[model samples]
Target chain A: MESLLSPVILFFALGALAAFARSDLAVPEPLSKALSLYLMCAIGLKGGVLVADNGFTTELFLAAAGGLALSCLIPFGAFVALRRIGKLDATNAAAVAAHYGSVSVVTFIAGNQILSDAGMAPAGYMIAVLALMETPAIIVGLFLARRNAALTFQPRQDLLRETLLNGSVVLLTGSFAIGLVVGKAGFVPIAPVFETGFTGLLCLFMLDMGLLAARRLLHARRLTLHLVLLAIVFPVINGTIGCALGAVLRLDTGTTTALGILAASASYIAVPAAMRLALPKADAGLYLAMSLAITFPFNITLGIPLYSMLAKLMV
Target chain B: MVISVPHRKIEILVDAPLLRRLRQLASEAGVSGYTLQPTLGGDGDQGRWLDDQVTGGAGSKVVFTTIIDAAGAADLLSVLEPLLDEYGLMVTSSAVEVISARS
Candidate 1:
């Protein structure tokens, strides 16, 4: 319950309330985008520092492989479920599945904070793992989209290029590699800028996210309720599988919870932008609103706590 | 005397997918290219425009332009009319004098 009242949670709630009330309060788009970049840099740097402190190990590589595998596999399961049960056509189903398969960096950031406040420590290489998980699901989604199509075209090449080298993925992975190369001595001079102001910046960015999410939800009736239900339920199922994998991997409670959170979080940034170019037939309001508005809030606010608690039990 | 062809510039407000399809169709129909711009806001069958940032899809708008021969415009309309039955598209054509002949 104490987690619910933390300043971070409170700020998120305030943003949500402002949105629900239809207030004009919003964070500027450019600033929000900048804040997202800043958060990625900070997390990457911190992860690099942790790797330096603890020294690299084979386990790190194993964890990264695990993360990548999850990113690739989840969408297939989600696509099948959404198509078979939810009655979504191939294009929309693939779009939403790609979302669930990718990671939400904001949710990961929030989960790290929640774990730290609970006096638990997580792995640093998880940052590298987060970046690794962004692209493969999109590949899978594209394949699923084209498999059922009657006519095949050369759009796959363009789609692959976009997914692999998209802005967010490039920034995130490039920053992580930079952090690893620079290590502690390199980040020492810049820690004040990246580390000190991160939380405030996150709050501001999330305020913008909240406003965007609310606006999307207001236009939500256009989406079928079946898809909405899938959005709400899919994350919990993914989190369950992640927690089980964490237990098998023997990750510490904190790291396991964070992994679960990462698994549960869905991508609203890079994947959606790529989908716009690749799957033009997919409805944006359906996937974006469901992922950003519905699933995102649920994961950050309640799902984090629940996953953490479950991690504690398993660990 | 320069002969001027009286033509109709058909304007279509279409969804992004259909807009792309229409553009290809227009190009195939022998109409010289067209111009497409980002639509900031609009209202239609989906409902009122809450805000621009809210919706992620380009369900916004695109304007396709071509000063086509009257017979070609009518033919293009025939192909599009059935597709627009289930989707959002508004087609209107007006008479204009074209002297350049290539436009």
Candidate 2:
């Protein structure tokens, strides 16, 4: 409940309210893009700095291994549910599954904020886990889409390039590397912008996200009740698995909650672009509606707090 | 008086991720040059999308325009036909008069 009333979350709610009211409230596109980039860089740098302070530990490796396995395996379960319960075709199901398998950078950032406020900052190396979790689901998704098809499916080299060199992945990992190189001494000079300004920028970005998510929900025509239910359900199930893995691995409370948040979140950025290129026949409307409109809102509003509570119990 | 030459104006509105493929098709079809423009928002069969909302350029749309000879336009259309339905690309070509030097 305290998390719900934070200024950042409240700004998000305000954005959604304005959108629902059909007000002319809007963020400039270029500014929104800049905010997105800034948030990634800030989080990446902070994560790196924290890692520099803590140094690499066994727990980091364990968490990374768990995150990678989760990323690679979650799609299979989601694909099955999407196909059987949602009644989607193979291609569409695969596309949607890929989204659920991946992580949302924003959700992780929000979760990290809430957990930290509650006095459980996640491990710095979790940022590396976040970057690692972005792409494997795309490979799995493509495999599932082509496994039963009659058409000769030749994997394109360009798709591989795009997936690896996605802008978000590059910026995030690159910033992390920079932070690793600069270390804590080098970070102090620029701490004001990346650290001090972090929450304000995140608030602005979340405002845009709230507007986007709400508007997408309003405009969604292809999202059925089954799909919506699955969108919400995927987070709870996947998040529980993540929390369990973290607890089993004996990670601290904060890092465990961060893992749960990552598992629960869906990719609206990286995977969507890759899916568009690789699975063009899949319905973009349906997949985006499920991930961005349904899952994103649910996570920020209720899912994050739920995962945090679960992490406390399990960890 | 300025003299004009007959040409076909080809405009394609497509998701940003597929713009590269569209450009490749246009180049293979022997198009000389083209311009790309960002769209703010629009509604179609896929529902509505706003440029500000899309972070990865996936749901965002772009407008690609080129003026080419009729033969080139036909060639471009043929090359794009296979993907038009698959990618939900909106393509239109119309006869237009351009300055001879520009053509």
User: How well does chain B match by TM-score in each candidate?
Assistant: 0.73, 0.90
lDDT of 2 by residue, A1-315 (tens): 999988779988988998899988888877888999999999999888889888999999999999999999999999999999999999999999999999999999988887888898899999999999999999999899988443332337657767898888998999998899999999999999999998988899889888888888888888889999999999999999999999999999889999999999999999988888888778777888899888988899899899889999998
lDDT of 1 by residue, A212-245 (tens): 6666677665567877788878889888778777
Instruction: Give TM-scores for every candidate, taking all chains together and pairing residue i with residue i.
Output: 0.80, 0.96
**Backbone clashes per model, in order?**
0, 0
**Shift in Å, residue A203, candidate 1:** 1.2
> Which regions in candidate 1 have their CA more than 4 angstroms from the true location?
A151-154, B1-103
Point to the candidate with the largest lDDT: 2
Best by DockQ: 2
lDDT of 1 by residue, B4-76 (tens): 7788888887654345557766766667755666554565554433324322323345666666778888877
TM-score of chain A of 1: 0.95
**Whole-model Cα lDDT per candidate?**
0.75, 0.88
